[model samples]
Target chain A: DVKVTQSSRYLVKRTGEKVFLECVQDMDHENMFWYRQDPGLGLRLIYFSYDVKMKEKGDIPEGYSVSREKKERFSLILESASTNQTSMYLCASSPSKSTEAFFGQGTRLTVV
Target chain B: DQQVKQNSPSLSVQEGRISILNCDYTNSMFDYFLWYKKYPAEGPTFLISISSIKDKNEDGRFTVFLNKSAKHLSLHIVPSQPGDSAVYFCAAIGNTGFQKLVFGTGTRLLVSP
Candidate 1:
């Protein structure tokens, strides 16, 4: 079975603070993604990495950045955390061009 | 605009009955469709999938049917059990290789005994 683990399950940060969410996958998948899920808005992609050091902006990449220094780890960074940035962040990984994606438990971030 | 839509926000079904969840997509370029079930406080799990090349795919009691002409897909769960209750999300990926998926808002399913 594939396992995707996140660094934190819940986090709280003050406004204007920097935040980092980490994800690691044991499947050695080539594609990893970051998504923020909101009620009524669904899961919107924030960023994705196809390979080490290669990243692409998804539909909603603003206020967020990602790092993929290694194949097994992906990190999402918030330059300046704001109240509006509070959301349930999910990390997923899949084989290149494959439809099956395994997701982590998700991190619920709260910005106050 | 929302490319994928799950019109029904919630559905109720009795145990041992069939629960059908529907999803629609506006993008005709999407060739792959997938259904995911998510329990509260947990990440969504891959339930089943159907490629455009096939009209129907079945896995045990869960089956997915696709209608290319209408760009509609449905997930049917037979003999619904309490464990089947969860939020079902329909997702699609375009023909573009390694493209990101467009997900529906999701439908909450409740199974009663």
Candidate 2:
């Protein structure tokens, strides 16, 4: 079975603090993604990496950045945490474009 | 704008009834579509999927129907159990270089026993 693991399941950070959320996939998938879930807004993509050192901005990439220095790991960074950035963050990895992606247990973030 | 849209925010059904969740997409380029189920404080899990070339795909009690002309799709769950209650999100991929999944504002389904 494929496993996508998030570094933390829950996080609390103060406003203006830099936050990092890490994810690792054991399947060595080539594509990795970061998304934030908010009520009534659904899962908005923050960023995605197709390969090591390659990144693309998604629909909601503002206030967020991502890193993919290796094949199995992807990281999401909040430039400066804000109250509005509090939400559930999810990471996913897919081996190919036409296949289903496996998701990690989300990390619930609270910014105060 | 939301490329994928789930108009119904919530739906309720009895245990033995059929639960239908609808989704529509505005992007004609999308060729692959998927449904995901998510519980509270959990990540979304892939449920079922349908390609544009096929009109219907079934896996046990869960069936996905796609209407390419209408740019619409629906998931039908028969004999829904309480365990099936969860937020259902519809996602689409256009195969534009890399797969960038566009998701709809999920529909929360509640199955009563």
Q: List the candidates' TM-scores in order.
A: 0.98, 0.98
**What does the interface RMSD come to for each candidate?**
1.1, 1.2
Candidate 2, superposed: residue stretches over 4 Å from native? none
Cand. 2 Cα-lDDT: 0.94
- Which ranges in model 1 have alpha carbons more than 4 Å from their true place? none
Worst 10 residues of 1 chain B by lDDT: B94-103
- Scored against the true structure, residue A2 in model 2 reaches a CA lDDT of 92
Candidate 2 clashing pairs? none
DockQ of candidate 1, scored on C-alphas against the true complex (2 decimals): 0.76
* Clashes per model (N, Cα, C within 3 A): 0, 0
TM-score, prediction 1: 0.98
Shift of residue A74 alpha carbon in model 2, Å: 0.5
DockQ of each: 0.76, 0.78
Worst 10 residues of 1 chain A by lDDT: A36-45
Pick the DockQ winner: 2
